[model samples]
Target: MKNIQVKWWLLLLLIISTTVSSCEKEDSGNAGRLTETDFMVAAANSDLFEIQTGQIASGKGTLSEVREFAQHLVMDHTTSSNELRILANQKKITLPDSLTEDNRAIRMRLSGQSGVAFDKDFIEVQITAHDEAISLYEQATREIQDPDIRNFATKTLPILQGHRDHAVMVKSKIDSF
Candidate 1:
């Protein structure tokens, strides 16, 4: 009776182990060809560009600070986007030339507003977008299967975090003003 119980316990453990390992394998994305990661990176880059251009072009907020943040976004995201472009090209992942419809619609909406209204709205969007981006980067840092893709996420995470922090600070001022 003791032997039977031990065997059953062992069998359960084996089943659980197999299940966990299989889930890990599937989550890693088929030997890390980077299809999903690349798509996400490309889309993120497009959104960054869309927001940067729109804000810089139509921004009415404390122009000095908005200009500073706009410049940083251009510099940091452009560099990261270029790295992503290189990786995508090497991995043969297709890259898009423009932002998706949803992001474009957001940019158009921001462009339509003016003065403090536009400033507040744009800052809020930046805060929300950076927060979302931080989470995405954090997940990619863990779940990305390819060494290269994982490294890119790791390298870019601090920069994204900084952007998020700056955005939050600016947002508070924009909101209060």
Candidate 2:
């Protein structure tokens, strides 16, 4: 009878342990990634980087097409950034006023180049940045816990995808030249 009682107690303990473990796993997952505040900051930094790089290309690019593309980047990214700022303001989220360290490094590298080199490097940067932006917005749309942020992501994703497609096309043209 004691052995039977021991077996019942062991089964209960096993179930309890599993339940606690699963709960911990879920909590840690939320803590680990895709937090709303982190998403906002990242988005803002990307916008700032795009704006700054586009401004550089506008002045330094030898290719007229590259200059035109840079103008588009400046206009579109400015609009997106303003909208994001408004949203962040409404949500009481503070955004970074400058680019992240990685983007600042890109800006410095692009600043050192001019003419054809500048044009090529700027196209490459746009392609990579837009790709990353698309992925980030897509992930936020899918997994963000905050309703306002998720909705924003869903609305912004198509625009980011469009930018990515444009950048890819521009990169291909640059490669062919």
lDDT for each of the candidates? Answer: 0.71, 0.86
Model 2 alpha-carbon drift over 4 Å, by segment: 1-19, 29-33
- In the predicted model 1, the residue pairs found to clash are none
Instruction: Compose the digit string of candidate 2's lDDT tens values, residues 14-96.
Output: 99999999999999977757878888888888889989999998899887778888888889889989988998999899999
The sequence of per-residue lDDT tens digits that candidate 1 reaches over residues 1-177 is 999999999999999999999999898766654355554665455546534554563445545666577667777787787788788788777777677677778777876777777767776777777777777777777777778877888888898789878877777777676
Error of 1 at 84 (Å): 0.5
Cα deviation of 93, candidate 1, in Å: 0.8
Least well predicted 10-residue stretch by lDDT in candidate 1: 50-59
**Candidate 2: residue 142 Cα off by (Å):** 0.5
lDDT (Cα, 0-100) at 108 in candidate 2: 100
RMSD per model, one decimal: 6.2, 2.5
Q: Per model, how many backbone clashes are there?
A: 0, 0
